[model samples]
Target: MLVVRVVPVGRARLVGAAVRRRLVPALTGSAPTASILTTPARCNSQLAADAHRRRHKNVITGPDAVALRLHRGHLVVQHPRWPVDDAFFSLAWLRDHCRCRHCYDNSTFQRKTDVRQLSSVGNPLHFNVNSTGTVLEIIWHDGHQSEYSMRWLWENSYVGARHREQRQSRLWQRCLWDGRRTSAEDLTSVVYDSFMTTEEGVRRLMKGFLTHGAAVVTGVAPTPAATQAVVERVGVVQHTMFGGVWEFTADGRHADTAYGRDELLPHTDGTYYSEPPGVQVFHCLAHHGHGGETTLVDGFAALNSLHQADPAAYELLSRVPCAGEYRDPSRRLHMVGDGPVIAHRAGAEPTPDSLLRLRFNPYDRAAARRGEPAEVEAFYGAYGRLTELLWDARRRLRLKLRPGTVILIDNWRVLHGRASFTGRRHMCGAYMARSDVLSRARSVGLLI
Candidate 1:
């Protein structure tokens, strides 16, 4: 006959001992199993005593011993009587204070409470295992207590899976800023004579280009010649039917044309081209107009709103790639890209991939139609939603372009258009390929 002894430890020790005692008789299958030699009453009494010992040995006095070590940021705990690994301590604390409202109802919104404000406190209020050790609770400075279960804490604490999905649904893009003030006396000479003529200016310009996806250069003359000066310095000027020279006329007939429309909503220009120029340069030749305010909205903001409103719709748009086309008797071009009206890269901090062109000109859509029903529906749905957000006046920043100001935008990052013009307004605009800027800047050692 063989006898086995099992020692209980932590919460599972008692259960393990009970299982061992019950298995011995079942395995032997003798007349009364191994306990036949002893009286039934004595055997029953012995079993009860063993159960009591096991329960008492496993009893935890104050908050689970494992939880205490974690709050202290201790790497290891070895009291011999109660030994616990770092994972046991670390994971226990996380399980308790999951930013989710189920554990901490600090706000109606389930966003994690800001920890930045707590930096001033040496050791701010934190949730921990209660003194009784049976349940976990938050120990507030005011002496309030909120108990939470281990299972609930664990479930909400590790939200990496959900976070990954969020990142995938955002769009990422850049904006540009030149930081050159208009007040300088020799703004052009300051720009031309300085390193801007050398390598440093090129680098600074490229840095702004990469940062904001657009930039402005002051002191440059807002003339066709000045436009050429910029084109010569950076990249090839992007040309369009309304390129090189642009007019801001109140003539109703001129307004009917694409270039003449006043009070224009936010829209990416040149959606009609198969490959819209990657960047746009507008030199303000004139701006005496009263209401022709140039409004700019961070397309990134619009994309985020769409994502939060309808994640499923957003996902569909991102996955389905579509073609945008524009055509006239003389020229026809199409743009091919993947993403929803607002698409984002997949990561922890999601950003917009592109500020999808959203103004729905039926005439343009009709020309671009390749005859796919599902794709068409998806495009219209995303386009409509994006247009609604862009036109929301509150989100925009209205700025009037004064004469001699040059605004360069990453065609992909910005959607430039005009408000109604009450008075006189004239502006010259040009498009420049992004590649041209990169190549020229590199030649000048501005870009590495």
Candidate 2:
């Protein structure tokens, strides 16, 4: 009888689909004809017992004794704690993923091993854990050796990958907030000098921006150039038809009501673009007016509130597509876009992290094509409820922008508007690409 067995190393489980399909046929040639006995890996309880018997290490015994067996071309790993089906890893996979100095380049963080040549490396003839149980040593059929830390192996295992994914999902979850919960004082505010001079200040700015969907920098030089500088520091300028850095007054320079004194409702910009800007910067260079207060509504917080109050309405908004268009005949500019009022990340359910963008701009919104009367009624009913929440004064954070105060908003998450003004109010601001803002945030460790 040809028997092959070794003591189990650690609590490794979860063989991914790809590894199972590719390695199983390559390893076994066909199903096994002989019986194979295998033991589950040492779980925490077993590790504790092992610790107690460390004085007589390598003397594993009892029902939970560590052991490995070859059934197909896979290393089946059982876990006593789970009492589930065995997990597996291929001998070829083990060899290809060896992180030794020869197979990997730590300096560049690249693999040196040629995966195409893995077939010639031969199978693992024998494998065992070190006395400390921290390392797994394998002697290959071709006399080559490989060693991998138990910690690394566990992390790469199916259970480990799932754990990592969950942790990341939690980290990426947005901290949704409304005006009642978040006030001007609650927001992260930095002085212009500190924000411009210190890396820590920038990191703090990004962290707050990601956490609250908005932040403020005070005491910035009250000039267009200064505002442009501030925007550049955070991210690259996202050029639009308006220009890279745009300044507008209540003059008839453009066609939009933004050039007039009429009050602008709470809405996100670029509803007519497929991919809207992520961040919007506003620096009131001069506001010698009476009622040009800026209104910021946390769209995520509002949606969450809606979800709690009326889940069906929230679902309606998320499921229905709303069309938007922008047309400037003078400039021969016409753009059209359409998407759900609420959007989610690809391949993910509507979790806080996966709720990617909010496309709510009633100004640019176009009439939907005729639909079933019930569907239209449902859509309008949901849209009306959402609008009421947005228009709620208590839920709005109104800021009377003055010279030297700059507000940076996550355009995709927060809605912005302006109160009708009486006198001169010139504001200079720019848009930043979503990728650029997120890249800046990730560079400062705000997100993974």
Candidate 3:
């Protein structure tokens, strides 16, 4: 007799659905006859004993093995490790997802055949849970075989409780850090050469950047390419019309004052773009100066304090959109956008969402907003309060970036500025997308 089987590879599993088939001549007393009738799933005691020999790497004994059971037409898994149990998948899903060599193409990781055409009569003839209880082997009415791993089952397990867990994870708010408390030691900095050359260094730097929305790497080449190299360690450097990794000097010709020798305020760049830049990088190439320090303010940290002090003010700023404009006469370029001074989830009530980006550029900010008289007044009041909190001396961290120093900022979350300089201070920098930064983190298993 010819039998076909599909099974999961390694440690992934599934369980779920309907079936059909034909009865053999010996059973039908005639030539092969089709039978569309559905039948109950039967457990196989012999195959179950044989499957016991193949142990799963992550299995536990005793009560843990009791975590799995057949309920009606479904395979129910009760794992104490995670809060939720997977009791949703049917036998059909388990059968259809078989990853056996005949059923799946291992090289391309693609399914060889469709499962939807399986007859309703295709119920399991027998099933076995291995010693680790992580794998389940099954035999179907048509003599089809399958092996499923518990890890795959749990990863795909989705139910009402799963959504609740998702919401809980999303509500995480970063702890506020100010100058006095969060110093170079707290935020931590990686050596530039090591970060570019080693996996451990890249992971360490990524950890700090992901955790704080900013990080520092020292001992670079003090050049534009050096800044690009730091960013490229994780992902490619994103280019804009401003060009890739351009140098910033007092004498360089550019539309923005960032090219000139002026002290900038704590603000996020690229608010003028519809889709603002995600991550911004800066490298100090030469520093023969007195005051070219970089300033960073934790915008979310500021919002937390503001939320505690004044709910009305916080709500107003989070609701009202402010204006940002960048105009270059030489290039005949004009860019503008209006968004919340403090970006967050948009709703009538104030519930802090994960992303709390700040866009406070006094120089780039347009004139006072025009709106409903009362709403506009409340917005201005909230704006003033937030500015006061952001500019507070204690809240800002000032770092004198020397040559060979690179600072990376999350343009969406952290606000940055420059301390005025007198002598020649040249800086080179680049910008990268937020997605690439995060993709590299996942690629290295730093994030899942």
Candidate 4:
């Protein structure tokens, strides 16, 4: 094996043609791992390939390691400065991902190269790392040349250190909290004017919201228009059958229990939708009677507890698809959706690190054939266990929603409910798309 060390881009020395040819390994019968070429069943194809590269034991390292090389039909790279995997990228993948102006249009976010047309042009006539070691130049047999910056490659490489950091950062941003770790007083809050007018206020709110899955803006003018304004400030209003920025009082204005004067258990909204809203806003305009307090529960915290207490139950919830629906014959509306209560991250399986979102709304669930007798029993048992944790007093934060205060909860991560009230309670709020929520989080530098 040819050994070489990586230096700072500015300090890297050019090694002419001799070094380049030597980096291309000889025909030693060694081949890329099978795991790298074939995706496993029920796995994200890209992630599965990445996982293999990340776990490869023959990682190029050491003081004399060849940081960049061509082996068998793959480009292997290892940056000494970071403790990441030895990335083995196939020539085909590299050609398809070329971001040159000819292959990609930067201005329009459009791709000029069609992946389907790259099969005949995957062969690289020659490949070279520039003297600065910051750019990789590849000349294809088809007379096309592509250049990729080392930084860009690292960012896009699934096995790179940056990729690991990004995934871990998202997981770390979520700090699970319960009644013990947080309280009504400890729930994050910001001044309404500051939140509406300043970036600093938005940053504080977003940080808190990302960390705890909930936040409050105090002093919001307790009106439907004012509440709508606050919702729009964070993201575009997600319109549903309920309309944008809806107002509801203690009357049968809607078919759901929310329109009545009854206590609602901790649950997420829009379980019936294929893609549920990311955030739910609530601003109480008036409450004439008593016993109408908003309840907040961190679904993740409950999930963590369940995972530790009963792995089997947690696994069941992560695998079984629960059917949810919203029906109203009078209004001619009947929406239906289904998914695992504990949704895994995209392309991931039922692992702790894969837990991405939660969908828990017992009231809105539609009847379904839950499989075999044993499976049905297990599903219900797990469902009941999770519900118990969600209802635990020690895991809940109850607070009275008052005028001039707007509360926003991550419907994907937090469960919310209301206490039974006596007289009358009027409120206005709207739903926000999950993408917009993450977009704001990314804009404020809370997420990458």
Candidate 5:
């Protein structure tokens, strides 16, 4: 990749300073000599320069230079020394992305001027690569000065196979885990206080939760705010219908079974919403109950097993759409969402990577049927097979949570339930949006 540094307009006098030692004069018939930019930090040391090139797999090197020329109203961008991925940017695009302080906001990193504001762009006045081979200087058709890194352009080039391969390597790939794969390993745990206090500890917490689908945070206070605090450390607090954070206390109600004492089936929460919560957290405030042990299963892993056992069944479930709804007559709230038992990106061909996302919630399903009689029959057959594979002895995990113990789950990947309960059990928890988790992960290089 090319490294770039922009010199201020006033610093133009120093342009020849770098060319004296590093660059030889190059001209295409009376054009001013191409000036070279010098960046000591990136170009001074031989070891650092080698390391930079190695990071990019030697796509661009210190000796590489951007060769600019105007030919038939199209700007030709070439690098004779490297030329790993030559490209041409239209004058329209370059004018739009001018990074000058006046045209773009450095603090917010937002473009203040729109490309539409320019009435016309004819041709560039001049262009050249600076001495150190890091920055590309351009004086555009509209007299707007700009600088860019040759490496950045090469890395982002859409025409090059190297750029595509490099990007795919960094994409977040999911690993399906089941009772057999996860086994006796805890998936590793991090203390809540340490995770809240240090960056390294927080990264470890993220690694455990994101990589394994769920993680236990020990020694968290058995309070509602503590659960909120733990989730807020990684992202913004996600508010939902249940409020910012809520507490469930087995209220012994007859209507709302969630607040009563019974077995909660292995299912995802809030399938009724268009965008379900990405993550769910529960901090055990009090768990004096004997049979309310939490049952956890990896839904994706179960699907993989079902596919291996019966591909026809998996295909049926993937094709039949199921309705998920929430109705509260007294509160006057009813929301519904419809999708297949195994959700996949619409219009995308089926594959292992395309199976990255799915949803299953037998309990929350509304009283609605899709497809014809034969298709409905086929769907249930596949659904039953999937359910059987999920509930098998080797597929489920049963754990009894204690007070001060916290559980964080990737709601999209894992299904959680509670066994039958006898005594009082109070749990305080909250939700987190998917965008927050993804943005935070990408920020710290966890996802890519």
Candidate 6:
């Protein structure tokens, strides 16, 4: 009779040794045995065929491991690799690469590095089935080893492969003053005459909105009454203590002193409201005043900068939930939500067409009111970082709104602020609900 035995080597040698120590001595009759030797026919071609089929089915190929044997989508692994099988690889790894400023630092946009540029040292870059044939371990060329359950590798591999695409699609342009001269014509062409009341005009306007978060409408009467009339036709206007009906004036008020400063930081208005207005309409009744240049920033651009500079920070912010608050002697509101400073609706990819939102306010007293010091500290950390990005000159679009102009913005997507005024200034501003705008678009058959 011919006998053959398979043995594991290297790290697997111990298992091989143990198996041989127990079985070989018994088979050779040195140890007492209960049964006698069987006939040669007992180990027939059928048995060999069955064994061969099982072995062939068990081997894994390509970047995947063999233990993760999938037959018609069924997971057949009895055991999985370490760290690789843990959910950390799937969740933490991706979160660490989130392309939002809350998770990254936007100010370092130009310094951001690409993940594909990472160096792969001598780590075993592939997975191999262990000697026991029950699990797989990823071998790095550097001699580092990580075991992953077959299912875990499969799931994470899918996500890991998708990371680059997600990152690229979410990448946005950073609007900066390049020191290069921009012609007034270019600026006017980019921002003005973007809104339309006609079918083709509406199409162009929507397309512009998708490309730029805000656009200017020319040929509209520059008066406050004219601006308010347009706003009312599209949606209900949001009125606030800082509100006015016509070309109203904006000076720093004691209650909300942000607008009073000569230089204003980039920020979204109505952040304190539970459901802040989603769009803002600003009409220039007069621009004879000095400074007070209206600045608009693409929040997506700022977010992309952060994602490039500090991925770890970006991940932390995106994973953590935050509370935004607004309070005064007369009114108070609080909002608790989970999202990055820049985020799209869940299950959707972020794009220029995606709805973008930002939350920035320094005067949140929710933590003190609720007596949560840790939460407050975390919120402040995120807020302080975001503030730094807001004032970054490179990410802002500075413009002076001339009389006879109306600007419409997706408030959630663009952060608007002024560049301080030294003389008499007049402007009219109102909020248009997002629901109403979409409804208006649909009513006019602009959107299906």
The most accurate candidate by lDDT is 4
Worst 10 residues of 1 by lDDT: 33-42
Candidate 2 Cα misplacement greater than 4 A, ranges: 1-174, 351-353, 370-374
**Candidates ranked by lDDT, best first?**
4, 2, 3, 5, 6, 1
**Per-residue error (Å), model 1, residue 369:** 3.0
User: 1-448, model 2: which lDDT tens digit per residue?
Assistant: 3233444545564121000010111112332222223333333334335434542235323333333334445555432322334556676788888888988888998998888977755435556554433466776666667887755665576545556666656654457777777777777898989889988888888878888888999999889889988888888999999898899999978768788999998999988888888999998988775999899899988888888899889888888888788889999988888888999988787744468898999888877964456789899999999999987878888788889999999999999999998989989999999899888877776664
Full-model lDDT, candidate 5: 0.66
Q: What is the C-alpha RMSD of each candidate to the true structure, in Å?
A: 20.1, 10.4, 11.5, 9.5, 9.9, 18.0
Compute each candidate's TM-score over C-alphas: 0.48, 0.70, 0.69, 0.82, 0.73, 0.51
Instruction: Assess candidate 6 and give its TM-score to the true structure.
Output: 0.51
Number of the top TM-score candidate:
4
lDDT of 6 by residue, 264-302 (tens): 666776665665678888877765657887777766666
What is candidate 5's CA lDDT for residue 339? 75
lDDT (0 to 1) per candidate: 0.47, 0.73, 0.67, 0.76, 0.66, 0.49
Q: What is the lDDT of candidate 4?
A: 0.76
lDDT of 5 by residue, 252-366 (tens): 4323467777888788877887777888888779877578888788888888777788888888777777888877776677888887777665666654445645677877788
Per-residue lDDT, model 3, residue 63, is 28
Residue pairs with colliding backbones in model 4 are 4-65
**Stretches of model 3 off by over 4 angstroms after superposition:** 1-77, 85-149, 156-175, 345-353, 366-373
- Which 10 consecutive positions of candidate 4 have the poorest summed lDDT? 33-42
Alpha-carbon lDDT of model 2: 0.73
TM-score comparison, 2 vs 6, better candidate: 2
By TM-score, how accurate is candidate 2?
A: 0.70
1-448: candidate 1 lDDT, tens digit per residue: 4333333333422111111111121112322222101111112234345433543233222232231222232112211122223223332343334454544667664545355533332211333333322234443333334465433433333323344334433322243212132121212222544424666665566656655555666677767787677656676666665555454455542313444544676666554455456677777677664677676655555666777886655565565544444444333433333222333434423334434433222223334434357677766687667668656766665566777666666675556667776655666667776577667655754332
CA shift at 192, candidate 1, in angstroms?
6.0
After superposition, candidate 1 runs with Cα above 4 Å error: 1-196, 243-258, 319-364, 371-379, 440-448
